[model samples]
Target: MKKDKPKYKLIIDAAVVVIAENGYHHAQVSKIAKQAGVADGTIYLYFKNKEDILISLFEEKMGQFVQKIRNKMSGTDDAVDQLKVLVESHFQMLADDHHLAIVTQLELRQSNKDIRMRINKVLKEYLVLIDDVLQRGVDSGSLSEDLDIRLARQMVFGTIDEVATSWVISDQKYSITELSPGVHRLLVKGLCK
Candidate 1:
């Protein structure tokens, strides 16, 4: 049976909040069902299990995130500008969705090793976008051709992840958007020729 798009979104949104509030081990289908305002059995109709819910939540949110950045980058021709937009968009998305930020940065990490591995797979799409920008910069002579794409991508992603996690731990007092320019500058300096 086909599910309504809004209903599916609501379920995912509710799951994020439930998971964020309760660690993964404590997050039960019943809790998510209550958060979504659906019966416990209704969750089963949509998801096979709690792990399924978590995986789907990551997939849905990350998919939309990647698509939004892809659309935004379509208007910019410069690789450097695209990289800036990608960094800004990523930080801004996490900042704008505090619930999602908690889920992604905190609760999601509480999952077992296996689940974390699957979540990493979903995150690769975003990392690939970063790599694409770096490759473009190298091709355009804006960045050093000798830069190792894999290591550069890791540094960029790892730095941003650390920054975001620190903000989340600190209660997010300052605006994450403010860090975008500095991050862009540092990345460009490290990678540019």
Candidate 2:
């Protein structure tokens, strides 16, 4: 029987949950297959190996994330607001999906160097979007021209990442969505003139 796109997406979703619940080392193909409701052999038909599934998952989900933010920010011309949307959208994406939060914030980091590199490749698109916003700010004289775009991008990413990781570690007790404005303010204050 031929599998459809939705079926593949379902498998990836199941894999994310399995990986999040069980660390990467402990999450076996068989376990993911069971969680995905497909036979172990069937998983092979869709993915070459476990690593492929992970890379594919990041690509698919992160692609959607970038697309959504791009769509939402279309009418907003202010670089600061663009930056705000970027940060908020990122946190909101993870917040909306607890399973994805666990997988992205915890389990995915447990992968080896190569897998991590691949994940970074998938994340570059988002980083580029941040960089574009910073560049626009500099161009408009809204942000300090002396600021290092690369380091600034890293700072934004690092801050949001640390915040999300903290939330995950704390069992998500606080409202991540509520923190967006403050985070955006701090970032803007530091980066702007």
Candidate 3:
């Protein structure tokens, strides 16, 4: 119910900027509230505490992110084209929002064990999405039938993830989206029969 409210989105969007700038540990609820133009106590009205906010933030953002990627790749029969769409969408999303890129690629890594675990839980859905794409390629013989789906998923996800992390670390010095075609070709070639 709260997720449907305008203020909920405002708070979530505000948390992205505050957390990216301050790091998760230093990103105070008051700071996020101020950024959202809401009272500090209002944060508690929606979230249990700072960790809850962080978890909710990732859940909300990544849920939307994965859904968008799926939507983009839908109706595409070619596995290679699906891979390209995934690569392009992933890079474009971060490139479109630097603050979100920082929050996802950098600050999210600083979370505690429980927080990190929850973050990983959200990430598993994405990993599974990648796996499904790989399975489709195998089923259609676009990729090697004997390909190890697990390792392929790791390679695809790891490559994209490393690229994003490097881009974030470099202060966005270069175009991350420009490398999508190359990344797509490299991964698809390795996966192809």
Candidate 4:
């Protein structure tokens, strides 16, 4: 598959920077190729068009994002600890990658309906991870037994998402990672009490 190639990753990384700097609509393939230090035609070999690049880039980044959270949470068995890990990891990832933060919190939202739909498809895996943590919490009685998994998942994800977006909008003037504890506490309280 094209994803296995080094160039595919190069293009994806390049696309992230390009899209973040220029916004999705203005991120031309030639610009991405130049950023990746590849010929313009080379991108075609890996993607159908600009839209394909956007979808694939999101898919790749989000996959890595979920994996990173999983790895970080692996040391803990407590659902509450796992939830904290997820919140901390989510904020830390955006804090670590400013470009990625901009793209995800801003440019990605600016995409058309079809692209947004595809991005949602990619997001399902991450949501399932959240659901798993919530399920574990209910099982362990750390969270409300009456907790609606679907609603709680949305709230947890939405809260984390809003905080990140606010950071991006403020030009990242403050430490988003430092706010992780507060965010975690808020979610835990909602889930537990």
Best by lDDT: 4
Can you write out model 2's per-residue Cα lDDT over 1-193, one digit (the tens) per residue?
A: 3234666887888888988888778889999989988889988888899999888888888999999999988878788989999889988998899888988999889889999999999999999988988899899888898989999999999999999999998988988988999999999999997
Question: lDDT (CA) for every model shown?
Answer: 0.88, 0.89, 0.93, 0.95
Residue 87 local lDDT, model 1: 87
TM-score for each candidate, following the candidate numbering: 0.95, 0.94, 0.98, 0.98
Better by lDDT, candidate 4 or 1: 4
How would the candidate models be sorted by TM-score, starting from the highest?
A: 4, 3, 1, 2
- Each candidate structure's count of clashing pairs: 0, 0, 0, 0
- lDDT against true structure, model 1: 0.88
Q: Sort by lDDT, best first.
A: 4, 3, 2, 1
Q: CA lDDT of 178 in candidate 2? A: 89
Question: At residue 83, what lDDT does model 2 achieve?
Answer: 90
lDDT of 1 by residue, 67-118 (tens): 9999999997688899898889989999999889888888888888988999
What is the C-alpha lDDT profile of model 3 across 112-156, one tens digit per residue?
A: 888899999999999998999999999999999999999999999
Candidate 1's TM-score reads: 0.95
Worst 10 residues of 3 by lDDT: 71-80
| Candidate 1: worst-modelled 10 consecutive residues by lDDT | 1-10
